[model samples]
Target: MEIFWRIFDTLILAGGFVYIFIRYGIPFFDNRKKGIELSLKKAAEYEKEAEKLYEQAMDVLKEVKSEVENIKKEALKETETERNNIIKDAETAAEKISGNYINQAKSEIDKQKKQLFDEALNMSFKFMQDIMQREMTSEVYGKINDSFLKLQEEAFDRRSNK
Candidate 1:
């Protein structure tokens, strides 16, 4: 009976120690687990913040690309407009030059025509005066004059018929 009593008492003491160890040990480890979980949560928050910053950077890059394209388009449009203006100005200048050349050619042709007309009239007047002077100083001056007058009348009548 004494031996049984001693064994029972030792068992009870051992069970009590086990119970204390289980309860207090579990709470202490739970505090460490909570700290680890808080660290993990902070890390996830930082990851989310980094993702937001990356998204903002991407958006800024897109805006820069759009602005560059707009500037290029504007530059091309302005260059095209300037080119068209240059072409128009060149065309107008060429037209004016052509018009000036045409007018000069017309003026030259008119001057040549007037010169030819004056020469023809002067030649005809000289030929007719020579014939009249030769006929007036003949041996039979009156008869020669009368005959020349008759020939002149016949030439005038032929010209009128034509």
Candidate 2:
């Protein structure tokens, strides 16, 4: 039993020395541990930096989207305003044209009416003069005056009867 225990202790010590040399490097175990720990710390710091950059990029993208939306809305409003202005201008122009046409038509009608009245007055005067000249013999002229007086007297009598 003692011999078996002595061999086990020797094997355990040799295995421990081999494991330490492989894990911590052959030169200095503490130096190897510090180098590994520093490398891990640097890796963690770089990961955190990459995460911060990603967040900043996402924020910038969101801001750009918001600005684009605002520009689109402004453009739509401008287009609508322009459309309304054009419609109003067209309506005003149409109304003005219609009013001018109405005035011109009224003027033409008044001018035609005046011309018709003048022609009628001229015809009436010419016919009256022709009739007077045809009846200008002294005896016929005296008889026309007597007949006109008699006609007036009959009209006055008819109105009194009514």
Candidate 3:
């Protein structure tokens, strides 16, 4: 009979302990599970946002790279245009200088030719007067002088007209 009472007391004590665990411990564990689930959901949302931000960053990088290439091409084109303009301007200046030099040279040659012709004509007239004074009589000399003067006047008129 003592052994049977001992066994019955042990059974009651075990049943009370099991009731307390079911009432309190199960709710505590259930709340902890709900919190863990909420934390996991929030972590998943954060991961998705991170991926979206990464994609946007990559897109922006691509646009910036494209713009840089376009700027380089535009700079090269502008440089080429400026170089061509400089070359064209230099050529035009060279042509203008050459033309001026040519015109000046022609003018100088024409002036020299006219001065040389005038000197030759004056020397020939002096030579003819010396010959006539040495070789002719006064009557022949006077007639030759009048004829020579008329010819000289006609030549001078022709030269002035030209």
Candidate 4:
């Protein structure tokens, strides 16, 4: 009879616990499920925003890369232009210097030629005078002087007529 009563009491307690869990635990679990869903939705939104930022950064990086290439091309072109100008200027300077050197050389050669001609003429004149002095006596010189004076007078008269 006692064992029967204990079994009955245990059954009663088990029934009460099942009723409480069904009434309270179900609502608690449902609330927790809704909270988890809300958190997952927020996480998805944050992930989308992060993806959009990454795309924008990539676009900016591409533009910056293209701009850097353009700048490098311009710099290379400018450098090439400067190099050509330097070469042209150097060539012009070299030509001018070469022309000046040639002119100086020609002037020096002409000056030497003139000096040689003058010296040769002076030498010839001295030789002729020495020969004339050695061959001619004083009587012959006096006769040559008289003849030269006559020839000068005749040349002067002919010039006055013309």
Better of 1 and 3 by lDDT: 3
Which RMSD values do the candidates have, in order?
A: 9.7, 9.8, 7.8, 4.3
- Alpha-carbon lDDT of model 4: 0.95
Give one digit per residue, the lDDT tens place, for model 4 in 71-124: 999999999999999999999999999999999999999999999999999999
TM-score of 2: 0.55
- Candidate 4: where is the Cα deviation over 4 Å? 1-39, 139-147
Give the per-residue lDDT of model 2 (tens digit) for 67-117: 999999999999999999999999999999999999999999999999999
Each model's C-alpha lDDT? 0.92, 0.92, 0.94, 0.95
lDDT computed for candidate 2: 0.92
Candidate 2 residue runs with Cα over 4 Å from true position: 1-47, 134-136
lDDT of 1: 0.92
| Per-residue alpha-carbon lDDT of candidate 1 for residues 1-162, written as tens digits (9 for 90 to 100) | 999999999999998988887888778789989988999999999999999999999999999999999999999999999999999999999999999999999999999999998998999888878987776665668787889999999999999999
On lDDT, the stronger of 3 and 4 is 4
Clashes of each: 0, 0, 0, 0
The better candidate by lDDT, 2 or 3, is 3
TM-score of model number 3: 0.55
Error of 3 at 77 (Å): 1.7
lDDT leader:
4
For the record, the alpha-carbon RMSD of candidate 1 to the native fold, in angstroms, is 9.7
Clashing pairs in 1: none
- Report the Cα lDDT for residue 110, model 1: 92
